[model samples]
Every structure is written in structure tokens, then in C-alpha cells.
Target: MFANIIILILVLLALIFSISKWRIHPFIALILSAIVLGTTLGLGGESTISVVLQGFSETLKWIAVIIILGAFIGEVLRETGGAFRISNRIVKWVGEKKLPWAMGFTGYIVSIPVFVDVAYILLQPVVESLSFKSKRPVLYLGLSLAAGLTVAHTLIPPTPGPLAVASLLGVEMGRMLIINLIVATFAMIGGILWVIFFLKNSWIDYDKKLQDIYKEEQTTTHNELPKGNWLLDIMPIIVPIVLISTGSFVTDNLSGWVGDALGFMSIPLIAVYIGAFIAVFQIAKKDKKNKVNRLVEQAITKSALVIMITGAGGALGFVIKASGIQNEIVQIFSDFPFLGAMLPFVVAAILTTATGSITVSLVGTASMLGPIIDNFPMSPEIVAAIIGCGAFCVFHVNSSFFWLLNRLHEVPPKVLYKTFTAQSLIMGLSGLIGVLILVLFGV
Candidate 1:
């Protein structure tokens, strides 16, 4: 027992050092850790190899298609200017005084199928325009938009982080979507509140510095922006969420062909594929066949690295389970099962702080916790949500998104810390609260 505990500690320390200090790829780190753990735990060469392969293959079987399809949809949304249209139209509706609220909601919607960083960039112009006109601080709007985008980007699927964790933990896609939307909505609200209280007072002179610097670039990009229809822009994203939710509801309440059809549609892979098909037709450059093909290729190439990382995570998870470390830990902590619920949140927060990559945090923490949580009494879906919340926490100088916001707005460091970083912390804590409520009510 003592030996197993020591091996587990060593594996974790090595993982953190390799990824954070040595800058090793997570795929390599996870795979190496799995081999080392297996050897240390007395799993022979043949058994270790077999376990790793099985874990990797099984996890890919569930998530590979969904991840690729989701990425393709995101890529198309990104390249087509549809994502920009969605945010621009929505921001226009709410008008100036409520600019922060509108941008927050826009980011929430836009980020479902687009990366948060991409969403931030796509929506930055609208934010800048609003801030310029209203003379409101850009950080207010930037943090608002980022807050909404961050929660959905981390918690919800079709986004890679939560999707990978959900798949590895065997959470059904429909259920994952439904629960996360509820949890993420609350988390987003928390973020919006933070923006109002913390950032509303901080002001930057957009007309003097930012306007002179960015005016030309903004005008040129606005003219070149793709002119796509709004309905077509959102249909691909909305349809899947609706179909998946409806299918989940129907499968539970009804029967016969209708239920069976809903069940088929609700399958995450098929639902996402259907959305992808819809999105492909709305390509911003539909006339350029070569460009469209290239976009698809780009998405595929991007997804390949994510697929390998997720598979490697599964390999490490399988080895952990096989080593019986999970059982020993669970027994040791038997009196505090609630800690099991909180474990993912704490570990993911630490990893994200260390690595500055939410995907790395999600995949790595989920890989470490997935096996043990599988044996826990609560739902794995909830555990995945907890991990997602943790991954969304505390973005600082180390985060890429932090730098992007700084470059775009040039907010003072103190305001950036209080606003952007504080809002993220609010979102994460709010999500943890939501999870606690669910656990308390015995969900």
C-alpha cells in the first residue's frame, strides 16, 4: 500500500514537471507516465501494453468522431465570418448602456462551436467599437465577453476540453450538454456580475490612443468581413443542441419509432455530424472549392493532436486503474466522498495555473481522476463538470487569452488583474457552487 501511494505521488510530480518545466508535449508525458506507473505497479510488459492499447482505443472510439466533427464545425464558423455576424448582430440589439450584457451573451453563444480565443478575436472589433462610442472601459466589455466565452468553452461540448473529459469518463453526450448548459449558465452569470462591479469604473481613453492605433486596421477588416446570413450562421450550432436535448428528453419519456429516432439523433457523434453538414453548406467562401477543402484539412490536422492527447490520457487512466492506486486512495478517503467531487476541481485549477492551457488541465486532470471517480457513487457527468469549472479558473499572465486581451485593449495591469482574473475566479467558484447544490439535492 505504501509503495503504491509513493508511486502515484511520483507519477503526478513527474507529469507536472515534464509538462510545465521541461515543456514536453502532454501526449508524450501521459504515455511515459502510464508506462512508468505500470512498471512500478508490477504490471508486466505484456499486460501494460495491452491495458494502454485498450484504454486508448476505447476512449477514441467514443470521442474521435465527435472531436473531429466539432472542430470542423468550429473551423467553418471561424473562417466563414458567421461567428462574427452572430456576435455583431446580437451586440447591436442590446444597444450601448447594456453593452457588457449583450457582449457577454454573445460570447456565450459564439463560443459553443468556436474556440474562446478565436471568439474573443472575432468579437473584439464589436467590443472596441462599443467602447469607443460609449467611452466605457474596454476591459468591462472585454472581460464580460471573455467570461461568457470561458465558461462555455470549458464546460460545454462540442468544445474539446469538456468533450474529452466526458468521453473518457463515459458520460453520455446529451446528458453532458444538458447539465453543463445549466451549470455554465450560472457560471456565466457570475462572470457578468463581476464585470459590472469590478470593471465598470475603470476607463481607458479609446479615442486618443486605441482609436488612432487601430482605426485603419479596423476599417479595412470591416470592409473585408464576410457577408453571411444570420440564420445560416446560427443554425448549425443551434440545431445540434436542440436535437441532442430533444432526443435525450424523448428517449427518457417516450417509446417506439419516435423514441428510437430521437435516440439515434441524440447520439453525440451523429448529432454533431448533422450540424457539420449544415455548417459546410454555409461556408463563407462556398464558391471557392479549393479554399473550402483547405479549411476542412486544417480542421482535421488540428484535431489530430487533440485526438492523440486524449488517447494518451486514456492510456494513463487505464494504468492507474490497473495499478489499483485508485482503490487504495478511495479507501483512504472513504469518510470524505465529497472530496471526490471536489478533487477534479482542485487538481484542474492547479494544472491550469501551472500549464496555462485549459485543454491540458482538462485532459490531464480527467485522465488522473476518471478511473477513481468511475467507482464513486455520484455521477461521472458531475465530476466532468467540476473539472471543467476548475479548468476555467484564474486566468493570469501565463494564459494565452490573458495576453490576447492585453494586446487588444492594453488595460493597466492592476485593472486586468482585478477584472479579467477576478471574473474568471468568480465563474469557477460559481460553477463549484452549482455542483455542490446538485450534490446536496442528490442529483
Candidate 2:
């Protein structure tokens, strides 16, 4: 038992150091962690190999499809100017006084179906436009938007990170979605308030180049498209969520004819695909080219990269389980009085901080803590929330989102650390506090 515990600790630490400090890709780092975990727990080579392959295959089957379809949808929205149109209308509705809040909300909604990077790129031009018009700092506006997108991408469902964590813990997606919305709303509010209270004091002088572009909007090579209907643009994204939530509600309560009918209609994945396809074709028809096909191809390519990285992380989790390392760690935690309940959050935070990938943190957390929860009588909701909350803590250099803010928004390192990084830390810590309070009350 002592040897096993030591081995688990060493392997986990190594995994953290190698990934964060060494700049190793998560896929490679995860595989190495799996190998070390398997060997430490005395799993036979053949069994370890089988577990790794099976885990990758099983996880990819479900995740790959959703990601691919979602990516295609995102690409289609981007190419057709749907995202830009929607954002512009939102800015107009909210007016300049609440522009930060409006931009944050736009990031939150758009990120549900779009990749974070693509979402940022799609929306950057809009923020730039806003800055030019208002003569305000683009950094504040961009950071507010980044905060919204980051929170949703990491904490919300239908995105791969939280979805994978929910699946690994055997929690329902609908429940996860509901909880995610609650947590994410708080996080976004925190970010928006930060922008209003703190960033408003700082003045951002507009660049000469941006001023030139703003003046020549009509003659510029890229002209803004006519504003599209906000309802039309938003409906495609919301349909799947509404259908899934309604289905889950019916199946949970009614459980009769009504429930059966709703179940038949609830098919979320199908709804999403159908919605996306319609949007793609509609945009293509209006434009008179095969833009839809090109967007689909781009989405697929992007989705492949995300799928492979996530699958590799899943394989690491499976290897840990098969090798008995997870069980051993669970045993160690169970022997402690208060540690079992807290272990999930602690380890998840550590992994997330080290790896800088919430997906990897989720995989690692579920692997180490899922069996622990199974050994206890804790509520799965609480456990799921704990995992989700834990994954949010400590957004630093290891995280891609960190570099994204620095590079894309041109936020100085000090400002990035102060605003974007601090926002993530606050969001994560607040989530954990919320979960802890619930756990205390036996919720």
C-alpha cells in the first residue's frame, strides 16, 4: 500500500511537471502518464495496452461526432457572417454604455457551438470596431469577451471539457448543463463587473492604423454584411439545448405517454446536426457558392485535432483504472476522515493548474476520484459539481487560454495576469466555494 501510494504520487507529479514546465503537448504527456501509471500498479503489458486502446476508441466514438458536427456549425456561422451579424446587433441593442457586458454575453452565447480560438477571431473584429467607434480601450473589451468564452468553454456542457467530465462521472448531461449555466453566469458576471469597476478607469488610446480603417469602412476590402436576423442566428444554437433539456425533464418526471413522446422528439445530437445543416445550406444558397462544403471541411479538420487530444487524455484515465492505480489512490483517500470528499477538488485543481488543459484535468480527476465516489455514499451531483469546480482553479502559463489573451488581444503580460488570469482564478475558486457550501448542507 505504501509503495503504491508513493508510485501514484510520483507519477502524478511527473505528469504535471513534464507537461507544464517542459512544454510537452498534452497528448504525449498523457500517454506517458498512462505508461507510468500502468507500470507502477503492476498491470501486465497486454492488459495495459488493451485498456489504452479501448478507452481511446470508446471516448472518441461519442466525442468525435459531437465535436465534428459542432465545428462544422461554427465554421459555417463564421464564413456566412452570421457570428459577426449577431454580435453587431447585440452591440447595437446594448449601446456603448454597457458594451463590456454585451461583448461578454456575446462570447458566452457564441462559444457554445464554436471553438474558443475561432470564436475569438470571429468576435475580435467586432470588438475592434467597437473600440474604433467609442474611442475606448480594446483590451478591456477583448478581455471581457475572453473571460466569457473561457468560462463557458471550460465549465459549460456540450463543450468537450465539462461534457467529458460529466460522462466520466456518470452524471446526466441535462443536469450538468443546468449546473454549468448557473456557475458560468456567476463567472461572467464577475468578469463583467471587473471590467466596469476596474478597467473603466484606464484609458486606451486608439491606434492610428485602426483609426484609418474605421474611417474607410466602406472602401475597405472587407465590408460588413447586412445585419442578419438575430432570432434566426440564435435559434439554430438553442434548439438542441432546449430539446435535450425538455426531454430530460419529461423522462425524469412524467414517465408515461407524454414522456415517451418527448423522448422520441428529444434527440439532441440529431437536432443539432439538422439545425447546422439547414444553416449551412441557407448561407450557401444566399452566397451562390460551395462555401458550406469548404466550411464543413475546415470544421472537420479542427475537430480532428481536438478529438485526438481529448481521446489521448481519456486513454490515460482508462490505463490508470485498469492498472489499479486509481483504486489504490482511492483507498488512500478513503482512509482519511475528511479528505475523501475534498480530494476530488484538490487533485483536479492541481492537475488543471499544471496541465493547463481543463479536458486533461477532467480526465485525470475522474480517473482518480470516480472510484472514490463509488466507494462512498456521496451524491453524484455533488461529485460532478466538485469535479467541475476543481477544474477551474489556477489558470496560468500552462493554459492555452492564457497565451491566447496575451497574443491575440495584445494584453501586456502584467495586465493579462491581473485581469484574465485573475478572473479565471476567481471563477474557479468561487465555484469550489459554492460546491463546498452545498456539500456542507448535504446538497
Task: Name the regions of candidate 2 deviating beyond 4 angstroms.
Answer: 203-223, 253-258, 264-268, 286-289, 335-338, 375-378, 433-443
Residue pairs with backbone overlap in model 2: none
Q: For residues 284-391, what per-residue lDDT tens digits would candidate 2 score against the true structure?
A: 456455676677788888877677777877777777667665566666666775676677778888988888877778777876565455764467666767676777
- Compared with the true structure, what per-residue lDDT tens digits does model 1 show for residues 26-66? 88988988988898899989899899999899878868888
Which lDDT value does model 2 have at 343? Answer: 70
Rate residue 332 of model 1 by lDDT.
76
**Best by lDDT, which number?**
1
When summed lDDT is taken over every stretch of 10 residues in candidate 2, the lowest stretch is 216-225
Count clashing pairs, candidate 1. 0
